[model samples]
Target: MTKNKIEKIFKILSKQISNPKTELTYKNPYTFLVSVVLSAQATDKSVNASTVKLFKIIKRPEEMIKLGETKLKKYIKTIGLYNSKAKNIINLSKILFEKHNGKIPSDFNLLTSLPGVGNKTASVYQNEILNIPRVAVDTHVFRVSNRIGLVKTKNPDETQIKLESIIPKKWLKSAHHLLILHGRYTCKSQKPLCGDCVVYKHCSYIKSEQNKKNISSQ
Candidate 1:
């Protein structure tokens, strides 16, 4: 997209949701990291449900370690990929305690090195907790960006790079949340609510639909 188009898209999305935030519930950065880890291939509602009771007991890294892998698995088993997530969380907490003095690392490489934290999760940690201008391209961001003509890419990694390259710097921080909310509510995978979409005019998917309708009418 052109610079002017990018700016316009950012302006519209920003106006729609001024202060977008992660739906995952957490008290501190440590808990937030764990929540993001558990959120891989999982819904925020599901993560929140699991964390609600889990967080009450395991607030700090030490507490999480104390809970142990077996106990952690019990709390998170309801979530998909619970066994591995439990191990990662426990191991990551130990690293946080030993290395970072119980603080989440700010550096992306260091963050990604932790168990269960990939590029997307690291970006989320920086964006939500640290307020950094990094767009974490989750499934929602990927689908919404492609639908809205913001980025046309095959996978999440390519989508993230495309978005980082094009999206205005001012909108970087809230971009993930805005795109996520859009996909979750409007531009859904199964049935996008094109009739009510705020950016329907600029949406490539909707334009394609309109073209089909026009052709059929002819």
Candidate 2:
């Protein structure tokens, strides 16, 4: 995509989603970390449904440690891979309390060092909790970015690098949320709502589809 088109894509999206934020509900960084961990292979809706009551009771790392893995599993059992997620949450909570003074570290290295917290999770936390400008390349972001021709990466890591390099510095903080929302709501995986898309005029996927249709009709 040209720099101007790239800028316009974000401009239109920002106007559409004025108050973009993580859909996962959380009381604080500790809860946000736990929610992100549970969100692996699970939806934000699912994580929020379970964490709604859990966040009310346990608001800190120490509180999560007290809840124990078994009870934590019970709370997040509705989520995918509850057994493993519960264990990682319990272990990471213990580490955070013991080493980091029950605080979510702002440092990317330390955040990713936590169990179940990978590059994507750390980026999301940094973007949302730490107010950092990072592009967390989730499934939605990867698909949307490539389909829109902003990037043509095969993996999330490449997509993250390409997006950060090309995306406007001012839009960095909100770009992650915008791309995710676009993919989740409009530019879906199986079938994108091209008619409703604001940037469809600049969409390579849409143009390619049109080309294919014209050729087939001929």
Using TM-score, give the best candidate's number: 2
Per-residue C-alpha lDDT of model 2 across residues 79-144, encoded as one tens digit per residue: 999999999999999999999999989999999999999999999999999889999999999999
User: Which sections of candidate 1 miss by over 4 Å?
Assistant: 215-218
The C-alpha RMSD of each candidate to the native structure, in angstroms, is 1.3, 0.8
C-alpha local distance difference test of each model: 0.90, 0.94
- True lDDT of residue 87, candidate 2: 95
State in Å the error of residue 194, model 2: 0.9
Q: Which lDDT tens digits does candidate 1 get at residues 1-218?
A: 68898788778877877777889999899999999999999999999999999999988999999999999998998899999999999999999999999888899999999999999999999998888888899998998898888888999999988898888888888888989988888789899988887787777887888889999999
* Candidate 2 to truth, TM: 0.98
